[model samples]
Target chain A: MTQASSPPAVSIRNVAKSFGKGIYAFRVLDDVSLDIGRREFFTLLGPSGCGKTTLLRLIAGFETADSGAISIEGEDVTARPPFHRPVNTVFQSYALFPHLTVEQNVAFALEEQGMARDAIRKRVGEALEMMRMGSFAKRKPAELSGGQQQRVALARALAPRPRVLLLDEPLSALDLKLRKEMQIELKMLQEEAGITFLFVTHDQEEALTLSDRVAVMQSGRILQMGPPREIYETPTHRFVADFIGDINLLDGEALPGGGVRLEGGTVLSAPHNASGKVTVAIRPERARLAPAGEGALEATVVHSAYLGTAMLHKLDLPGGGTFLLRQSDPTEAAPEAGSRVGLALPAEALRVLDR
Target chain B: MSAALRRFFLLSPALAVILFLIGVPLCLMAWVSLLDKGGTSGVDWSSAPSSANYVRLAWEEDFDGTMILNTSYLVIFLRSVSLAAVTTVLSLAFGLPVALWMASLSRTGRDIMLLLITIPFWTNLLVRNYAWLIILREDGWVSRFVNMISPWPVQLLYNDAAVAIGLTYSLLPFTILPLYTVFEKFDWRLLEAAHDLGATRKRALLRVVLPIATPGIVAGALLVFIPCLGAFVTPALLGGGKTLMLGNIIQMQFGASRNWPFGATLAVVLLAIMLVVMTAMALWRNRRTA
Candidate 1:
């Protein structure tokens, strides 16, 4: 990651926006602020109506923020219209000009900038070639497949060489297999272009796979922002931990002796230096199944599911809470349904979430 | 029945209507246009078919019994075409912005505007033309207002300009409705995409919206132009017999001159020109698609 010494590629400060007016007004983005570093692939991850897409649109100048300011590459662009801004966007629908061929679509921005004909031709050719769409340059967008149209959209947005590229769920239209293929291509393209990419997606896995950092949003607020590993392993918010991946949370009380007391009167040794009520969160893969009455917590196995690469065991704790353990070792026998088992919760793997 | 046979059966009713309403009259007109003019019966049923009436469009027999070029009919034809073209251009100029504005309005606002546009159509065409005659007459308020601003008296009625105004006023809705439909279905995100790509509003409109709405614009133009070319009431009422068009000349041939062959020939020629224009447009559209 680049140091904070330089101005970030895009900085959003205290931006708030709402739709409608008066009592019926709905706040879509509330006091959102973030800085995306140069050449970094940053993603806003959230579910629908989480204001992630709204924030991206603000950066692209499609919608102006009701309050606060937005700057691109150290230049204030909050008051400027979309045409005056230096950034481009790959819209979710691709938004390729149906009348123009792929080459012309990629050349549109350069033409608007009054570039020379020869330069525009060269740039359009290079951009299309970079997207592996050189052969289809003469075809209109309707003639191409959805994935090919997506590549053309990317090419068009990148051809202008904007300081930042905002993508609003560009891969949501593609099927699962095509979405995966484009995800890798998108990452490589970001690196090759050497520009900051602000991507918005509701798919958490996509965000984790493509972004250098991910910001989790809910109710128009950024709950947490960090590297994917940090956001996944040490999410400060309970929503983030559950939204990112599958995790088991148990209600417990912190004891003065540096351990947690379960609701069912079971005490397990923990390493956190906190006292009072807390929620202990652990990923299913982080725990293991032990023989009955031999591990940190005793439980009865409810069922086991085969997940091709791993086996998932659901257990009912004595406190009536459920715990899941993921076992990857195929050689070990899985506890059958209704069998009693104990769960080993490693101290380091346990996260103490207060909210 | 098979799908193809079922489709044929389903289409036969429409085909029969077209053949009876459109096809039979066209055949009758063609046959009448090929005959010679009869004294009082309008056509000589026993005369051999000939191209004399068609020739009469461009040539006239002089007192010396020699054919000479006739510029009178040519002038009328040119006037008719030029007026229709002017009406089409004026309708587009006044209708495009209205359609764009309507498209940008809220759903309720758009529906209200659509109702306003069609309200004029509820009135009879002859009554509307008479209203324009009243509005554009010498002492009428519109004409008096124009005269008030001018250094000299400005005549607003009984000219090609007045005919054009009446024609455009009557046909404005034709241009607005189709263009409105196209704009309503337009993907406005394309404009946003253009703006995001650094195009100013005007440039985006010129480069994106207008090109996408080409089909609608052409349809509107045809809707106005085809009818304007053969318009009889507006020219006759507003022109005050000073300016003659193809429709007026054809009307005179059948009503006053009792020359049925020439009247039929004019109608056939008008249909032929419209057919050629429509065919060319279809061909051009197909080529663009290809």
Candidate 2:
């Protein structure tokens, strides 16, 4: 039974998937549920083997859930095959047909639908121009470099005008510089096309840069789901905090108020509701390094790495615990290794997360 | 010695063997083909050099036209190419799905399927043709069983149909093997990519699977067509000796007629045709690589 006239772009509920027989069975997805809004750029970010790709496949109708319902545009598409679904994916390998010219590869799906030659030509031309690949349309996939082929793959996927576009680490095959460029191009393309994009990637930076909202998955479950800044600044769980970006976690006990007491007998205030044995997450940039007796905790600078724009300091606390600090000013004098230093945990920058 | 000279020295043995064996015989064949035949004294070379033998072979003997016609140069060439094409299509139709299924199977299952595909290659080609001969005869088990089922039994032996069938059967493994290799190594994510892009199963197969498998299909087609051109055994046996194929005519000229010149001419023509086909294939392959 459906309650709304217009449904969400993608709706998945209690999906489970397993491979092999009884004794040899391996569960890859477990009770996974998600709802992607229409025309929203959604990302599933996680470590390898976290079932993010499987979840994307389930949404794309390439794989069926063992026990759940999937709906697209309000229709229950649980048994619908991938071809029937209004979805398209860009594979990580680029997957361009070697025998076809770049234009032919893009026009393939349209040709399969028996679209007229004129229309196919026009649409293919438009898509190629959109991807800035107009010049390479006549070339074979083998003739182009890695990044060019990736653009062709993107053009081919976008030419069909599917309701949803699924990208499975489409830029993972590129080198560092090309990958960065493609990330911006991909985000812009998704926005220009106005199609719901369900991108799957293990790269945290990619997820942060491209998604309107990201679902962080681990061990077949979504640990947290929110915008990049929200997920990075105010992670709701320990797993989310650690997976998204670099964070210095301080093991502490929850106080009566919205605060935590560190093992070093230092008290820090937080923004989340918490009680009894809790972990507070603070970004490396949040902590300021100074001479002992001037800051919150007595510590020693173990090592400092100059990273051009910033300097990263590894500090050892008095309680046999170590913390990392990232400072943007490389010109500031950082204490030498083995020198006693102070570690400052600013109340505004610290977040208490439930374990 | 320098690298180039040392390499030349290393290749001298093979070069010597080629010059002594292949090059010398080819040159002799060319000379013999040009010689004038004395009535009972065999070939005469002392006479003034002329295009007489080539001219006589083309106009007087009429063997050239008959041999060319009998070879069904047009039909056999087309038929052989089409046979390879059809076999490639059929093998992909059957083998690709089977290969995809096999690829999806467990390690043990894939090994078992691989063994099944390899089973045909292990047996001798002559034995396979003979086995087919037994199965396709007028009173053979297949015909007999069909007769029992239907009032009239189908006659499948000794015709072009039977030849095609035998050729297709013999070359099935060749087509399937290359296709299997292509399908086995195919990235399944591409199929997923097509589906995510709103392509149906049929479209995916046509667009993604077929185009990507072109290399294997072309390879399989060449494998089947080249051997099928010189197929003496299958056409001779399955075609019931009634068929005047080039192979049979060549055999008659060599064995019964003793016209070594005509037979050599036919052999040279067939080789020329093969060379043309092979050259075209090589060009196409090079273009693909480029």
Could you say which candidate leads in TM-score?
A: 1
> CAPRI band of model 2?
medium
| Residue-level lDDT tens digits of model 1 in A233-347 | 9988778988998899888898886788877888877777777887788999999888898889888989888988899888898878788889988567998899898889899
Top candidate by lDDT: 1
Interface RMSD of each: 0.5, 2.2
CAPRI tier for the interface of model 1: high
- Give the per-residue lDDT digits (tens) of candidate 2, residues A71-161: 8877898998887777777887887777789998899878866899999999999999999999998899989999999889889988889
The stretch of ten residues in a row with the least summed lDDT in candidate 2 chain B is: B65-74
Fnat of each prediction, in sequence: 0.95, 0.76
How accurate locally is residue A145 in candidate 2, as Cα lDDT from 0 to 100?
95
Query: Which regions of candidate 1 fall more than 4 Å away from where they truly are?
Result: A253-277, B1-11
Which tens-of-lDDT digit does each residue in B19-86 have in candidate 1? 99999998998999999888788988888999998898899999999999998888898899899999
Query: DockQ of each model against the real complex?
Result: 0.88, 0.51
Predicted structure 2: clash tally: 5
Score every model by TM-score. 0.95, 0.83
Q: What is the C-alpha lDDT of each candidate?
A: 0.92, 0.79
Model 2's chain A TM-score stands at: 0.93
